[model samples]
Target: MTHQRKQIGSGRNAIGDFAPKLAELTDDVLFEDVWNRPELSPRDRSLITVAALVAGGDSDQLRFHLKHAKDNGVTESELIEAITHLAFYAGWPKAMTGVATAKQVFTA
Candidate 1:
């Protein structure tokens, strides 16, 4: 089986067909194929992904990614700096929400 198919088979069962495909794309393709590239460290990738998710106001996704960001060596201060930088461009509200979520993740 292909890497995506293997991941799909091992993943949790979902109610819809598309959800599994989406998960495979995100897990195997995005995470494995792209994030695992040698050029960019996992820490940098996590920082970029988390910042994009936060700026996009994707709270649910951000919450999950925040933890991964920490695991990938994204420090609390770096996360805060990212949010602060986004505030000027992506809006303060989104940054505020991201900051709050980061706080929870840092404390956990």
Candidate 2:
């Protein structure tokens, strides 16, 4: 038996026309290859990705990942708690910003 990874076209929808190569790489390499690896489930990947974005204070990307994380079965409270916990290592300001971003995503 074999498992098939789900297909996603977020990259092309996001930036295919502006940067074809990046879009293709995002669609093929990141989403198809990296994200679909058997080792980690999509929910786990979403959590890690959200943490990275929060640590880097990448709000723009964080917005999307926040929703993505939720869609992947991560609860809103879990996400909030994760961000609150990240404050210690990732920095207070970054977590504060993450909170703001999370608030927007949660409400919207």
Candidate 3:
């Protein structure tokens, strides 16, 4: 399962034709190398990523990470709680958007 996730080519599948280098880097470097680093579990990384994405008001990417977070074992309530907690630090607007996006992800 770990090895399979590492070989993912979501970057390629999404934009390889227009951005080959980025695809390679996203697949080979980001996913394969960085994500596979053993220090932090994938669940930890996914949660961190979801928080950053929410804080940054990056809903586009957050959609994917929300799903990834759940796949990594983060519960729906946990995600909502995290987003709610981020409101104090990440601001109410961003947290609201995160909740909205999370709703879409979890329900779908």
Candidate 4:
């Protein structure tokens, strides 16, 4: 089955003016290579990425990944469970932020 690739960010439109190289790497290396790896499905990658973003308290990135996660077949229930599970290990504040970001993504 062909997996639909989710647009993770604004791509060149967001960074190309000031950081062309970074934009290129974000598009070519990160998304094209690492994310497109065949071993792990995009859904699995979305789970891991969202969890890591929550653990890092990186809500900026979390918003995009949360939407991408849903596009990749991750349900709202699963995202809720993941954030809830991470609260203890990653800290309550981070998980809470994740939940807030998730709510926005899900509702949007």
Give TM-scores for every candidate, taking all chains together and pairing residue i with residue i: 0.78, 0.93, 0.91, 0.89
Question: Residue 39 of model 1: what lDDT?
Answer: 70
lDDT of 3 by residue, 1-108 (tens): 344244243899998999999998999999888888877888888889999999999999999988888887889999999999999999999999999999998888
Which parts of model 3 are misplaced by more than 4 Å? 1-9
- lDDT by residue (1-108, candidate 2, tens digit) is 256446364988989999999999998999888988878877889899999999999999999899888777899999999999999989999999999999999997
Measured by lDDT, the strongest candidate is 2
Best by TM-score: 2
Off by over 4 Å in 1: 1-18
Clashing pairs in 4: none
Which portions of model 4 miss their true places by more than 4 Å?
1-10
RMSD of 1: 5.7
Error of 2 at 2 (Å): 11
What overall lDDT goes with each candidate model? 0.75, 0.90, 0.89, 0.88
Question: 1-108 in candidate 4: lDDT tens per residue?
Answer: 676574454567878889999988888888878888878889999999999999999999998888888888999999999999999999999999999988888887
Give stretches of model 2 more than 4 Å off: 1-7
lDDT of 1 by residue, 10-93 (tens): 222432255777767666776667766667677777788987998899987888778777777778798889998999989999
Tell me how many clashing residue pairs each candidate has: 0, 0, 0, 0
> Candidate 2 at 95: error in angstroms?
0.1
Q: Is candidate 1 or candidate 4 better by lDDT?
A: 4
- lDDT score, candidate 1: 0.75
